[model samples]
Target: MNSLKRIMVGLDLSEMDETLIRYTAFLCSISEIERVYFIHAEKSLDIPDEVLESMPNGMPADEKLRASLIEKVESYFGPDSRVQVDVQVVEGSPLKELLHWSKVKQIDLILAGRKFHMRGSGVLAQKLLRTGRVSVLFVPENIEPRLNHIVVSVDFSEYSLMALDRILDSALTRPEVRITCMHAYEVPTGYITLGISYEDFDERMKGFARNKFAQVLERFPELNDRATLHLVKQENEDDIGELVMVEAKRLKADMLVIGAKGKSAAALFVLGSVTEKILRYNDDVPMIVYKKENEEIGFLDALLGND
Candidate 1:
């Protein structure tokens, strides 16, 4: 599990900013986060000379934006927060600036707003998960700012283990917080070719999932009863991401955790199909897509000034 000592929160000055900032403060209070950077980006920092001259203190556009963001941060986090807080205003696309600055800071986790009915395209948050090497937490506009129960979407892949491991090792799992491992499985159509009945194949698939869960338990026996395995049967068009979200709703899960394709698609390093679907459909639950820091971003490393 990688320690999330430094986190970057992307702010676009929308109504989501309040939720993002307050939620960031909530996370900082719960986790071992050491530094938080609140960043806002603009397409251009250039202002007419007349407008600049008329400014009260002659502050640059970036500086003024920075001051406003600071007040917002201080309001939620308080002036004497033990965590070091910095507000940055940058030029260029918000998505580009966010990825670049997060890498530059070697940030551990990124908190981005998942807009439901916002003005922006709301693609930035999804793109960040797809393009960046860092782990990202998508905080929706409507959230309770509490994390009592976490649901990990598992396919028994390496990514699943990575997500579970991080949750198990993190300070966010303080005694009361529990982690649930949820897997969505389907009976392969090829089972018919193998002379297996649909019902038998379904049972077999579930048993295989249980065995995988047992392996997970063996790998992290410390998880013990704090985590339990749940396998859900997924039908055609049911969508694994949607199934996980449904399970989350049933469990009253506060946070959803899904792992990224690392060793398998290191070069591509994009969120898997299911993860992308979840990002699109989930607007009420705070979801985190976890990516290992050591994994290669492959071609993404040089993408659109990702450096």
Candidate 2:
């Protein structure tokens, strides 16, 4: 949000790797990203013995692969890149290497491409989403690198508020861009067991949800001028994540931004239940996952606290 100064983009040799680079380029063109680290994590350093035998005896297999990958990525950007590009090649699990590099280098954002057909890539992405410390932007294949409209999912919780704040603080929510602050709500299933008619409960729940949405908007008065508020009511069999995707499609949003509720049991229920499902859905819309920070209590507060 604070104009990402450093970004690390994860790349594989697959065709989608270029898509990640182009996405990074698109962001850099619009924001203040200063340095871009393009990284490829090779699963192993070992090469086939037959191929190794053909190469010079003194050459290292890892070094050869590194040089080749660097050249290939460089070809995509050529020499006239608007931002500083640094190509890096390493050997390890992709998730592990990406997490380590981002943390050690103080990366502000991470960019990666999602392959619809690759189940393994999806698993790796989920692992990164859970384990990585930095914000990640997952760009699906064939997505246009534009930011005309963005949908930020909100539950009126601190974590969702954090996501909205990040988008507002950035240049992404400019005047030309249409921003939608969307919240999805559903009545408790127990209402049916308690003899409440579904229709009766739904109407009551929707009224409550509308009031909550109004309260949330009241807190951010400027949003009234810059964004639109949308409240979605979930049906009996609807999942929250599915509802979010349906809203995105209905709104024709170019991007989706949502916050992870951190690892606390209560927080996990919010992010893990919905955001995790959305990640698996892979609807071809780009998404930014913002993780909530661990709020550290002050010394004065700690001393006076009663748990």
Candidate 3:
């Protein structure tokens, strides 16, 4: 619903990829999607050398693979569906090719599988997160789709506001949709740290959180009538990622939304922490990461060079 007319599904040519493609097709069936691209990114070495010995056979093998993948997709969607789908095979890194094709083809949404064991701090996932051009939906293996309850994390940042606005504007928000907006506050403790009293710090933090919640509700009056607000106080936990996952599981939330800072290419390649932690431990629920855009920055932010 967020101008997502074109969707690109990243496929790995495996059973899991097939499941992801089918799940994506199911989601698109209910939307105004005009086209679906089934993209398979393969390493150049995967192409058989014997087939490549002759230029004609090399092209034939690639064409055959494409046709097979297309056939599988069509079969899963059934013959009655009117969604137009095309198959593409590219040679490069999977994430790189997906991002490049999404931009070049003007894709609005990207649907990809979430790897469970491949959960270490990786650059590929971070790169996809920083791609502000398209909205990404990660489908975890063996998880069914649910649109009943959603949990959105807010910290009074413009990125959080933008994410909340987008979710409210999407098709996911219907009369049956139940949304919970959560704000987590942490109180610093321990003698090894600063000498500030933990109790006093907690009280101040709670007051600040309450005021911020009121301001957020006032700024977006439409959400006041639709979503419920919840404030969580944590004294020992510092990792917001872990807290968010635990709370989502406790509430049985179908999805989680967070505001993320876009990291530079070099930083991402070296160590991707935030997204990696979330994806590794919270594979049950989908996450929608929102990054701040230039248009959302105010004059004050521009003066401070925060934009």
TM-score of each: 0.90, 0.81, 0.78
> Candidate 3: lDDT of 3?
58
Error of 2 at 160 (Å): 0.5
Error of 3 at 119 (Å): 13
lDDT of each: 0.82, 0.75, 0.68
User: Superposing every Cα of model 3 onto the true structure, what RMSD results?
Assistant: 6.3
TM match of model 2 to true structure = 0.81
Off by over 4 Å in 3: 49-59, 117-127, 130-133, 188-204, 270-273, 292-307
How does candidate 2 score on lDDT? 0.75
Scanning candidate 3 in windows of ten residues, the lowest lDDT window is: 295-304
Task: Report the lDDT tens digits of candidate 2 across residue range 231-298.
Answer: 78877787777778878988998999998754533342244467788876756899999875432223
lDDT per residue for candidate 1 within 209-275, as digits (tens), equals 9899999999999777788887888998787767778778899989999997744344344445777
On lDDT, the candidate that comes out on top is 1
Question: Which candidate ranks first by TM-score, i.e. highest?
Answer: 1
- Any idea what lDDT model 3 has? 0.68
Question: Judged by TM-score relative to the true structure, which candidate is superior, 1 or 3?
Answer: 1
* Residue lDDT tens for model 3, 184-299: 77765553276667677777888888888888789878677778877777556456667768888898888787766555434544444555566556776867665544322243
Q: After superposition, how far is residue 18 of candidate 2 from its true place, in Å?
A: 1.3
> Model 2 clash tally?
0
Name the 10 consecutive residues with the lowest summed lDDT in model 1: 262-271
